[model samples]
Target chain A: MKLGRLNHVGVATPSIERSVAIYRDRLGAEVVREPFDLPAQGVRVCFVDTPNSQIELIEPLGADSPILKFLERNPEGGQHHLCFEVSDIAQARDFFESGAVRILGPTRIGAHGTPIFFLHPKDMGGVLTEIMESPKQAH
Target chain B: MKLGRLNHVGVATPSIERSVAIYRDRLGAEVVREPFDLPAQGVRVCFVDTPNSQIELIEPLGADSPILKFLERNPEGGQHHLCFEVSDIAQARDFFESGAVRILGPTRIGAHGTPIFFLHPKDMGGVLTEIMESPKQAH
Candidate 1:
């Protein structure tokens, strides 16, 4: 599989507002989009654009939120995953599957409006990884 | 601190040779530099150059290597840190310190032969971040 650029680094946080302050006031980041809810994923997210990639701040939005357990383990939150773009999500998924890498779930529409799938941490050397469609367009 | 490009994402591993196989044979990475040891840091590292940034694979050289604890917690190894380039290391260090951010140690030469320092994870949203001088001239 051809690996593309680093799209974004997902940061799980208890509050997107607080994460925004750190990226903005402390890091001198000038652009931080307003936080929005992804009810489908049960999380609120905001993008902190960087020179090369971005930082995606995500906060649990519902009781069944996937990141709820992560927050329970790390109350102050932490890096949840690293996302990389793939020219074609399907092809990339096929490649990982062929290599016996475990993918978490079926490809779904991501926050970027692109099809994305998360690779299980165990199969990814202890780091949760997201593979997303490049030049993301509505899926 | 002026954030330059994402230099690389450091992944701690038990073996660089094994990680190289995954990147080269599976991920289709074309360039995988030879592994070298940094005695000062007590870790061996190698660079896998990507289009935009790079992936750094680090293996502990000794039992007391800082990464040993990480590998202990995750026998499979894990993402150790994210490194970003900075035009001036001292200036970036000053900015972080002024913001009450914790610096792990005095600036030291990094794997890239660049002056670098790790910011305390607690002050960096639970991500151990590295700030390094870019276009590193061998010191």
Candidate 2:
């Protein structure tokens, strides 16, 4: 149940293009990948690569997207969640459940194509947290 | 203006002790440093070290703390800001200014005893961002 590196900081945005522009033009981020759609996850995702970690910019793909509610609360969008890596997803789930930390749902494949689960904000000090299985690229 | 590593993610909390326990016990974080008070910055800070980056848990130290309003808005505390390392603080400040981005204040020595400046959330897509001079230990 040990936590690994922080994979990325999830940011919800109304427009991925606008967010990308700021990260690149304003912040001088050099490696911003093209935005792509993840229909299964209902998000259009773009990854801004920093030297050690990434900033994940996500926009709702459809009306039923999970992050739509978050955008509603923060109209201009903002930091949405923090994703931390764990070596084993099942073991992490067990640890969280045993500790009475509420899991949002069953573990499912996340945007990065790894098994992932979310912890409720109420159980995570009011910050939505995502536990992701360590990605191969990270190693 | 090369962007350095993601220095740390700043988390605002009502209680640093409570936040430390959750990171240590629930998340199995191995290195939860002792909480310390920064009277000048008006924050009680504790750092939760992840393998690649750190989580800065900050609690309001005084009534006049800058984060008090954020706490009032998000009573349970939440993800406060994302801090990234820069090779030169003054150069970074000029770059941000040249792009028409709003700098929160004059670059000043931060809690880490390094020059740092904050960006206006409104200018950065509703997310507060901190630019910190790369720390020596990171190298």
Candidate 3:
């Protein structure tokens, strides 16, 4: 697949508010958006934009949220996933198909109207990966 | 601190060679640098540069390596630390001090010739964060 760029970095946190504060107050990243709850995904997300990339803070709203479980097990926050911007989502899917990696979606519109697909972490040595195709809005 | 940009995303893995292939072959990130073994840290690192940020694949070379111990606990790879580039090394140190976050260094450079410091994960809600001054290469 033709990878465009590093779209954004997803950070799973126990509290989105706290994470947002750290990024904005301490790191100097501007808060681009407020927390938006997504019940289907069991998450409340906030976005911060930097010069080069965006920082996504994801907090689990329910006990069943995967991120909640993740925090329960590993409290230390680290890299969650690396998203690569692609020109064609279908072509990106095909590339993963050639490999043993499991595709989570063919294509789906994400937070900012960007098409994206998540690769199963099991296939990528436990690192969650996402391929996205869309023009990101400047915050 | 005045954050410049994200320097790189660090990934701890069992095999840098295999990880490098997956990132380069599947993800399409160009291999800008080769694997370099840091004997002092007991780990090997390979760097891939994308448009926005860098992907670093790290593998422990010895049992004493911190990566080895991390892998021992979290065999499944996930998010590691997120590093932010700072314009001034001393100012970056001051930020941490102002926040009462424990600082790991105001010391020597790593990988590239950039002065760096680490904020304890406990202070950042389990996230390992690094503040790095722009490298001399950019000067």
Candidate that scores best on TM-score: 2
lDDT per model vs. reference: 0.83, 0.89, 0.74
**What are the TM values for chain B, all candidates?**
0.95, 0.94, 0.87
lDDT of 1 by residue, A1-139 (tens): 7777878888899888887887776666767887889998899999987777788999999899999999998787888888888899889988888886888989998988889999888766677889889874522
Candidate 1 docks with a DockQ of 0.60
Per-residue error (Å), model 3, residue B19:
0.3
How big is the positional error of residue B2 in model 3, measured in Å on the Cα after superposition? Answer: 2.3
lDDT of 2: 0.89
Candidate 2 lDDT over B13-124, as tens digits, reads: 9988888878888888999887788887789899999999999999998889998998999988999999989988888888888777888878887778899999999989
DockQ of each: 0.60, 0.84, 0.61
Better of 2 and 3 by DockQ: 2
Q: In order, what fnat does every candidate score? A: 0.56, 0.84, 0.63
Best by lDDT: 2
In terms of lDDT, model 1 sits at 0.83
Candidate 1, position B12, lDDT = 89
Model 2 alpha-carbon miss at residue B71, Å? 1.1
Per-residue CA lDDT of model 2 for A18-72, tens digit only, reads 9998888788799998788989779999999998889999999988899899889
How big is the positional error of residue A62 in model 1, measured in Å on the Cα after superposition? 0.6
